[model samples]
Target: MRLLVAFTCLLAGCLAQKPQPCASPALMTGAFTVTTQNEKLEMYCKYEYDALGQRMRVKQQGTYQTKPFTRDYLLLFREGAMYQIFDTNRTCIKSALKDKFHPMEIPKDATLQGQVVLGSPSAPGQGLLVNTWTGDMPDKKGKYLSTVTEFGCIPINNSYQSDEYGWVVVNLYDNVNGIVDPGQLNPPDFCRDTVMKTDEEPKNFLSLFHNLP
Candidate 1:
């Protein structure tokens, strides 16, 4: 009787599939590079997480060029603050983060559109594509700051990842996963002698990558 009951329980467990957790930062650790279709706009980024799986540090560096103009910069984020080091002006700017940023996750109420294979069609891994219409994410001030009308996400290996947003399409490659040195997150002392920016500066470095008319 014991063997029969155990076998029945195992069969029932296999029949009922449990819902997987959304793309929580707990699953993401280590380093990744943010790259675009054009190599000239490639950006290197590294992510460091604490014991609780919350992001503790981030280091990003890249060179942005548009024809005759080019600018190189290094960005570091940690302890609820961001530091930007510009190579052209030899200046370091600091900005404080008002709220903690949680990576986008697929909502429980999302509508499943379909499933698609990432990378190539013959790839062994597949992703579930979902769309959230009523879900609108506001900026820090509770004001609707983004023009992104459609919110789409693909959950692969139980993680919400997307390759395209608005008019930008890029690939995220994470090949490094290990301990990050503490010194990498620190700004040089020379930056202190240079110009300093207040916390009210622009929030993102989007303007560095492109030239808007």
Candidate 2:
């Protein structure tokens, strides 16, 4: 089955952070799977952050084991713009959102939740910090959008969209702490050409990463 990658189109400034939130600029590589009575779909992803605590790059690739077709795409966020690279056809699209960072933006009136849970006792004073919130956003047309999100303090469990994917759960198996290879954040030569809307481009690819997911 074709996986429907869904996420919020973030277009706002930074949401206020609670004290001692999870560390960032780390690498989170994992899979998002959705299963229902009638269909099942899965996608693998690698998310990277820059030293400045920003989501600098993300690459997602996957396909059904029995299918011949595959989907692969990379998104680079920097310089106040978002760059997309479609792996199948080596096409690039650019969107200048003028926002440097794209973490999910929580509404001003969103409900807040968090706690300081202790970690391993051996590591004294070390504890797990968690922040979860939910809120609603009305689009320009006045359509209300609802979202739920969770963030980890240690960056171990990290963060994921609780509401973006219906019946989908994001499980991250590998968490790498270090600087990401510069090459991974750069657009390849094939994608350096002018942007063009071709018939082969995936419609949701750009829409998903338009904000900070």
Candidate 3:
């Protein structure tokens, strides 16, 4: 009888454990709101990825330093270039993209914090099941907490804090698979005449927002 009881207890413990980490869809488009210490940015973003080539294009229209502005970013990792388009003046600045291609997935080392429902769980078809995970950033520069859909592993929100950059929270939504328009990744015609600014120091995606005017 004790052996049977022990076996049942072991089975129950295994069943209660969360599944392994899952990666989000490779090609997706989504809208996200990012808030930092003094800036709030709302952006519609498109991401395309493969082993060799990856690109992220973001259309940002928000307030920075209490000033309203609209801008677009094309970060081509494989090409090693980042293009910043100023929508207000139709000007463009090109710089070397310093960040590597990072997939939109929870890290394997992340700890599963637990599961939660976004809405009333008692109401049928009204609640979304999500899993929360936390871990140190790959670079170990900060720590992050993220939530994603339990079924599809779609990211819902993430918050990160670091002494150098302060705190940043991003809420992602309206995510769907596949690229809406392949042409959107291409640099605008107006940007063709704009020369690449190689003299200034290269900045990653997050730091680019910090230095924005």
What is the C-alpha local distance difference test score of each model? 0.39, 0.41, 0.74
- Per-residue CA lDDT of model 2 for 113-179, tens digit only, reads 5433435322323433344543342323222222222333223232223333333334444555554
Worst 10 residues of 1 by lDDT: 142-151
1 or 3, greater by lDDT = 3
lDDT per residue, candidate 1, 1-213, as tens digits?
676666556444533543332443333335444444444444555545442433345555554443233233333333444555565565676655344545535445543443322233222222222222222233322111111111122212222222231223333344233334644435557564544345364444343334421
Q: Mind sharing the TM-score for model 1?
A: 0.45
Worst 10 residues of 3 by lDDT: 43-52
lDDT of 3: 0.74
Error (Å) of candidate 2 at residue 142 is 13
The lDDT-based order of candidates, best leading, equals 3, 2, 1
| Candidate 3 residue lDDT tens string, 111-213 | 9888877884544466677888999987788889999987788889988985544777888888877778777777888887777678988767676556556
Each prediction's TM-score versus the true structure: 0.45, 0.48, 0.81
What lDDT is reached at residue 39 by model 1?
A: 40
Q: What are the per-model C-alpha RMSD values against the true structure?
A: 9.0, 12.5, 6.3
For TM-score, candidate 2 versus 3, the one ahead is 3
Task: Single out the weakest 10-residue window by summed lDDT for candidate 2.
Answer: 5-14
